[model samples]
Target: MAGMPTPHVSPGLYEVFLAVARAGSFTAAARVLGYTQSAVSRQIQALEDETGAALFERLPRGVRLSEAGRVLLPHAEAVRDRLARARAELAALRTLDGGLLRLGAFSSAGAALVPRAQAVFRARHPGVVVTRVEGPSVKHLGLVAAGEEDLAVVSPAADRPAPEGVTLHHLLDEPMLVALDRGHPYAGRRDVRLAELADEEWIVGNERLEDTLFRAAPAAGPRPRTGLMAQDWIAKLGAVAAGLGVTLVPALAASSVRPDVALVTIHPDDVPYRGIFAATPPAPTVAATAFLGLLRETAQELTPATGR
Candidate 1:
């Protein structure tokens, strides 16, 4: 039997190899792992030499994992995942008073919900640091899935399913409203029906989200002509206030609106309400769990006041 090659691969080398394989370029892997390209190359070479097998084949544009690398990739990934979980657990063992909370939120929740909950949580845990980021629900979910965020607040539209690998904590059912300039024809209406508004111009934030909810409306009709498309909720709200078109707003969003806009509830028989949920990473730290509990309590308090 051939003697086993001398093992030169350390845990650090395994990590670098995994990053290089995932990124497909030494430069990209270096950037992701905070290492220099030369260092990444050295680690891969060391691993290959120790194993007596070619781990990667250099290409003109980048690199491709060789047969040996393909065989090792899954095991390496499992090792990294276990190490990450161990590190998280170790960090959680530190003093609870000084831990950090990494949170993400969709636009409306960031504007109307997170601030209030943060204020209350900080008052109780003054030593903790709270970091927040705002983005669309899908983006927030992506961050949580990638381990960039501990928890995220999202509003799942009626037809959109909750994302995988996260535990959703239902907080409230926020009704959708039609936002328009105060002087618009539908502004003074107590409720707006989807059928009556089908012919009017609309300002939709995200087409996929709008379609997911609007298609399920009881009064679903021809899609409105999208006069302006906005990626940001604030911009969409501003467009609506400027009479660009009528746009849908959640109850939480309505509460944060400026005085120039009017919010009319969509008929219950029309669009169904959206649900506000707190989504946490598959495995969360103790501090994150505590903050989520506080968030749930705060959401309950804010729900009744919103008449949801």
Candidate 2:
């Protein structure tokens, strides 16, 4: 009887095999893994040559694993998962210095939370680098899930659930306020009712789902009509100042309102408060932890009365 040839597969070939198996097609795997389809095919071919057995059967649509391929699939998956975990753990080990901290944040938190935290963190540990991107809450959360960001500052919203393999640190429950042109009818009022503004044309933030916490008395009946939608808070505030429409903003954000605009409390019974949280991957680095601490401190300073 003829004996099987000795296997001589390389680690790179195994990685390619695992990617193809997970993705179910060379093209799909290449797209997900940032490699060319030809490269993936070559690696699989090399793997098959080394093992002296066919690993895949070419089909009209794609390819299917052969007997040899099926036999190695579990082992390949294990190797890939182990290598990924090792790389992440090694990166965490170099957390103190010379590592990147990729952070994402919603617009309001980007303006206040991230800046102050970065300032303090850089002062304390100058070796670590900080990178930040600002977007809506849902987008920030998605980045965290996709491993594009190490940490994020996001508001908890019903539609945007926390991603897997991530942890959340509740920072503070910030009250929402109505921003109106200084000459608007409710600008001087101590508090405004939801019913009073139902018919008013509203300028809503682009992330309306996140800002909906400010829509007081939503459970009661009709809510304010959204006439304009802006992604940036500054633009929304500008719209409010231009008398385009009323907009709701976080109290912390409202603290820095323009001279032409005023922020007034909306009754709590009508509009409920929303919380801000510092979110990160399950295993964040020392630098990330240090930065989060500074964020907490900055939030406290910003709202001394609440003490964060």
Q: Which candidate leads in lDDT?
A: 1
Compute the lDDT of residue 151 as modeled in candidate 2. Answer: 83
The regions of model 1 sitting more than 4 angstroms off are 1-95, 157-164
TM-score for candidate 2, please give it: 0.63
lDDT of 1 by residue, 179-204 (tens): 87999888788788888887778887
Q: In order, what lDDT does every prediction score?
A: 0.80, 0.77
lDDT of 2 by residue, 1-308 (tens): 65765555578888889888877899998998799999998989888887778888888888899999999889888887898988876775476645678888887776666787888787767767789998877777777777788889888674456778678887777776777888888888888887787777788765764347644354653465666789777898889889888877776665466878878777778766678888887887676787788878887777643211
In model 2, what lDDT does residue 188 have? 84
Count of steric clashes across candidates, in order? 0, 3
RMSD of each: 15.6, 14.9
